[model samples]
Target: MAAPLFLLAPPRSYTSLVNAMLGQHPQCFGLPELCLFNVDTLVDLWRGSAAEISENGPMARHGLLRAVAEIYCGEQSTATVNMALRWASVREHWTTGQVFQEIVDKIHPLVAVEKSPSYTISVKRMRAMLDTFPDARFLHLVRHPVAQAKSLLAINDGAFTIKVNAFEIGEDYALMEPQIAWHDINLNILDFLDKVPPAQQMRMRGEDIMAQPEQRLAEIARWAGLRDDAEAVDQMMHPERSPFACFGPINALFGNDPNFLAGPTFRPHTPKIPPLSKPVPWRDDGKGLHPEVVQLANEFGYV
Candidate 1:
């Protein structure tokens, strides 16, 4: 079986768009956010895990439910989602790793490309991915800290930051700070990636891919031992063609970002990268990125 390709990055880091685009490669199967590593067994997905983070809601299960429905039943619908429930019930005791492998096996010969930003919250979840697929390839997707932080705040007033416990605790109050999650989650990914073999890992800035997708996409496809010819690269350039690029059935509405889902199609354009030294637009206090955030962004090729 071809090992799966995992996108490791914080939320709002272009993961949904990139994952969908990669899945459009003729030899790859782009899957919705099958957040399998967030728990132990199939049943644990429903039981939910106790942790400081809290995005594991019904929406968290949408990806797996939709995946099973589409992979096994050949569609994502109210009926198929229910079928997926029964499917899970039969294998409820199986480890989440085992369940994920089954889905990957079902789509054999096509590389499974997936991204679940929640996995960045805990190194244990990432380690589980390696434990399941020892030869798995990881793509550490990064965005500019300033750009990413602003996006985080723009969406739901940066509510997702609360899910990661990203806060600035002042002497008198605690305020939601998107950059905290940006810094820490990236740190989590870097720390966990240290355990992965250099040969099995690759890093690329989200801006580069957005700006020059054809060239950069070809680079990654070549590295993954996939076809990088014009035809293949052209296919990858149209992420909207992927089956899971849009909303699923009403029962399984979102396995990806809602914003991306609203407009999953990719256009050739460079994303603006904000300067790390400037005060972030989201903050009223006129504060710039933390020193550590800037240092790490520099290492990621941001200035």
Candidate 2:
């Protein structure tokens, strides 16, 4: 099987674009966020705990279904999507690792490129990924937490972090924390990296990728043991060219973020760096980044 390359990071850290970009390489297959490892069995992706029950409890399954439909059936239609559903049912008892291996094997000779921010939610989940693919390559993607948190709050009332329980309950039962998701998720990546060989992993700043696409992407390709020549670098430059870059068939319109799917263009421009000393948007009162967050931003080369 081609080596499975996983992008490890928290949500809103440019994983979607970067994953798609790397996937566009001729020898790589870019996949949407398949949160398969969150459960033991394929069917567990559809099942939900009583406390978290919702109509979309199995939200992660859509990506797998659409991917299978697109790969096997050549199009992600209602019929093909149903077939994909059946495919999952056949392996309902399979572990996520086994299923992931199956997909990688099916796409033989082409590297599997995937990023599931959900992987950072639990140390166990990250461990599962490492255990499953001991030879897997990892890219620890980082972004300025201030910018990430601002973007997160802008999207859905900061509900994404809330869903992950990346918040603190104060004595008054108030959400009193800031950058909890950013800090903890990054810590997860750092801790997990200790278990993997240094040669098999790379750390990248999202800003660097955005600001210097050709340069940084070529570096990434070289580090991942892929071609870094002109043609390969050219291919990696156009993330929008990836089939999964856009929304899948209407039946499964998205296997990734709707916002990213809507605009998957690659423009080389410097991202606006938010001030670390500024007040955070998620809070009513003015409170800026903690000392540790500043240290992290500096460590991430964000200044």
Candidate 3:
């Protein structure tokens, strides 16, 4: 089986766009966030882990259900999704790695490309992926801490940060800090990537890709041993062409970001890079990124 490509990043790091774009390649199959690695066994996804902050709900299962439906039944209708649920139920006793290997095998030669930002919450989750597919390649997608933190707060008041226990405990209350999430999650990815061969892992700035997608996309295609011809480049430009780009059926309405689902089309525009020293706008007291965040961002080649 051809090992899949996994995009590792914290939420709000342009992972959805990049994952879909790469998946759009003629030789690849983009999948929604299966989130399988977050657990040890397939049933653990339903049983839930000890992390209280982690996202859990029927909705969390929707992505896997939708992907299974689309891959096996060639569609994502409610009926197909129900079939997917049944399919998952049949394999509930299997390890997550086993279930994931099945999906990769079913979609062999297409180069399955996937990203589940939640995987960055812990190094163990990522290690689970490597354990499953030793040959899997990793893309460590980075965004400026300032921009990433801002985007995180904008989404459900940084619920993801809380999920990852990115907080500042005070005498009176605990405050959610997106920058902590930004630094810690990237650290987790970096620590995990340390175990991967340099040739099997790569790092790219999300801003760079936004500014020059054609060049960057082609570079990634070449790195993945995929065709970098004009045709492949053109295909990568249209992430909306991916089956999981949009919302799924009413039952499985989201296997991806809702904001992305609302508008999955690729629009070329350079994302603004904020100065690390400036005060963050989200804070009432006008605080800037944490010192640790700045240091890690610099390590990531950010100014």
Candidate 4:
């Protein structure tokens, strides 16, 4: 069995593009967000989040639904997606590990490359994935906190973080908590990575990958014990070339980010790096990043 390669990062951190790029490699099978570890059982996905209705809560089940439909039935047709639900129904009694192993088996000999942003919300969820794929290679992908937070707010009225249980309400119903998602998610990744063998893990900045795709991707391939030749790097340059780059059937539009699905092209542009000490855009008051967020950003090579 080929060991899987898991990309560990919070949302809007270039995970989708990077996953697609790596999947385009000859020996790799980049997968959309499988989101298998989020729920204790497969049925819980349809149960929705315990939180009230939010912009992102309704779409939480999308990744897993798409993955199952694509993997089992080949295409994500409505009928196949329904079959995926039935397939999950049969395995509803099994552990997530067992279910994941079954999928990995079906795609045997090709390395499974996956990144699910929701996995960063809980240490337990990360642990669950690790326990299942003990030999899996992890790519700890990090982004600038300010850029990430601003992008998160821009997407869905900041409801994405809220849906993940990362926001807090003040007396005036104002959201004033600092770095709740960014700080905790990175902590979860760091803590979990400490348990893995150094040989099995590689940490890279999303900025670095964006700035120097060839060099950073080559390093990643080498670290993951895959070929780092010209062919591999060239393949990693075109994320759009991946089989799962486009939207699936009508019933399943995305197993990945919708924005990425519409346009998965890779243009070489240096993303603007926001100042670390400046005020964040999400807050009414001009307060800067929390001390913890700064430390984490520095560790990620942002500062």
User: Relative to the unseen true structure, what is the C-alpha lDDT of residue 78 in candidate 1, on a scale of 0 to 100?
Assistant: 95
lDDT of 2 at 16: 93
Query: What is the Å distance of residue 259 in model 4 from its true position?
Result: 1.1
lDDT of 3 by residue, 1-303 (tens): 789999999999999999999999999999998888877778878875334334545667778999999999999999999999899999999998999999999998899999988888889989999989999999999999888888998887777877777888879977788888888889899999999999899999999999999999999988888999999999999999999999999888887888999999988998888778989887777778888888998888887
Tens digit per residue, CA lDDT, model 4, 242-269: 7679887665666788899999999977
Estimated TM-score per prediction? 0.96, 0.93, 0.96, 0.91
> How well is each residue in 5-103 modelled by candidate 1, as lDDT tens digits?
999999889999999999999999999998889988888778754342235667888898998998888878899999998999999999999999999
Worst 10 residues of 3 by lDDT: 48-57
As a TM-score, model 2 comes out at 0.93
Model 1 weakest 10-residue run by lDDT: 48-57
Model 3 lDDT, full chain set = 0.89
lDDT values of the candidates? 0.89, 0.84, 0.89, 0.81
Note the residue pairs that clash in candidate 3.
none
Q: After superposition, how far is residue 102 of candidate 1 from its true place, in Å?
A: 0.6
**What clash pairs does model 2 have?**
none
